[model samples]
Target: MSIRARLLSTIAGQLGNPHGTLGKGVAFMLNRSNHRAIAGAVEATGVTAGATVADIGFGGGAGLSLLLERVGANGSVHGFEISPDMLSRARSRFAGEIGTGRLQLAEGPMTGLPLADNALDAAITVNTMYFVPNLDAACTELVRIVRTGGSLVVGIGDPDAMAKMPFTAYGFTLRPVAEVIAALERAGCTVDHQQLANPPIPHHLLVARPA
Candidate 1:
């Protein structure tokens, strides 16, 4: 691979599952850069007090933090991330909330979230779809984790815009928004699509619920 490819691969790997000292830095950047997607995705879920919600692929824990706050003292939040480093950071940062049973964290694969069927009042995932190896399982699992009237929010950058990034050349699957909506629909969801941001990223947020 060329030096550029090598760099792209390294960044791509870190983005997929952050780790070690360098990952610490990536985690910080993600928290700052992905705030809009994270916050909007959570809001799309309509999360409320006393409800149980989860932030899948919680990245730098920004989404997890938002969920924790929205769920409040009475509610609970479950966070699932594939990155051990990020999970450790979250565990440390939200120790008090975790100790009080207001937050739960898990490091695992996207295919299986370690959650019971219909366990969540709502769920949100931001910019993590491209890394999922199995789109079928990803779609199925998102719906499986949330109850029939419960909501799910998926956030991602437009495929055209994401294709502009070199890192996407390695291990990233640039899927069209329609393809994702179709997959979710097959899993029994009614998707509502809206552009969350344009130009630079062409970000989108898809809110869905069971038919």
Candidate 2:
């Protein structure tokens, strides 16, 4: 493979499941760059005390702590991560919350979240949609898990901006904003908000609610 192709492949591989030292380093950088977007997604969920929420791609757990705070003593937050390195780091960081039964972390695929159907009050995912093997299936899965009238917040960098990145040429799917909103609507969600920003990196935040 050409050097460029090889680099893209390596990035895609690490994102799919970061595992070792390199993965750890990448996770750290991801956590930093993704912090604001993650917070925005979680805020869009409008999570509250006594609410049951889930973080679909809870990488490095940047938003986990904030989610836990919003959930308070009466609520619960579940984190589903595909990366082992991320899962381990999250589990370690939130051990106290986990012990208190306020936070639960697991290694699971987004297409088949390990939770009861219609079990969540809200769900959020930041910078994860690009890596999903099937966007439609992933949307169906998320819609199935979130209860009726529940919120689903998905945060992503602007496709136009992300496309400027090299990995997108390899495996990342630069889904159009319109296409994503349509897919969520098809999955029975009513798009409530669509926020966009361009600085540092372009960002898009979509907030939807199940019908």
Candidate 3:
């Protein structure tokens, strides 16, 4: 395998197999300040205790689990992952929730969500926008699935920080935050909140409401 594939495999393995020997360490590391910042950004989008939610690119299922906790049993959480390996890992990690019907793991891109229009209360994506080749289409899909007044929160590494990272080696492009926000606005979403957080990594969070 190539170096990029190997690196991603290592990261995914560490995250997906939380019951594996490395799972505890990975979980612990995720609960630290940096991950907390990402989680907080998602929460700031206004997900409530009984809101149906979707977490796009739910790597290792960490953010999905966090969202589930916020929404509790009254709500349902759906996780969309394009990576087969990552989805497998997430399924294993949240087996209980999946089995009980509280969480749904869908294997596909957010561009073609298997959901009805205005079906969700909130949706969040973290550190995954860089992989989307078409920002406008993705934003439209996000807004289409969420109800009016629903929230769509997207978190991505700051372009400047991503430009300096090793992510380029893994095929990640550093997309400008302004471009993302503009695309969302053009797609008919009202800009509700935008902020940058500097922690484990420098990232930008954009929250919008369906118009």
lDDT for model 2, on a 0 to 1 scale?
0.85
Could you tell me the lDDT of residue 86 within candidate 3? 65
Per-residue accuracy of model 2 over 95-208 as CA lDDT, tens digit each: 999999999888778898899889999999888888887888899899999999899998878988988987777778889988888888998999865665753487888898
Instruction: Give each model's whole-structure lDDT.
Output: 0.89, 0.85, 0.76
Each prediction's total of clashing residue pairs, residues at least 3 apart in sequence or on different chains, is 0, 0, 0
Across 36-63, the per-residue lDDT of candidate 3 in tens digits comes to 5568666776787888999877765668
Best by lDDT: 1
**Of models 1 and 2, which has the larger lDDT?**
1
Clashes counted in candidate 1 amount to: 0
Question: Can you tell me which runs of candidate 1 are displaced by over 4 Å?
Answer: 198-200
Q: Per-prediction TM-score, please?
A: 0.97, 0.94, 0.83
TM-score, predicted candidate 2 vs. hidden true structure: 0.94
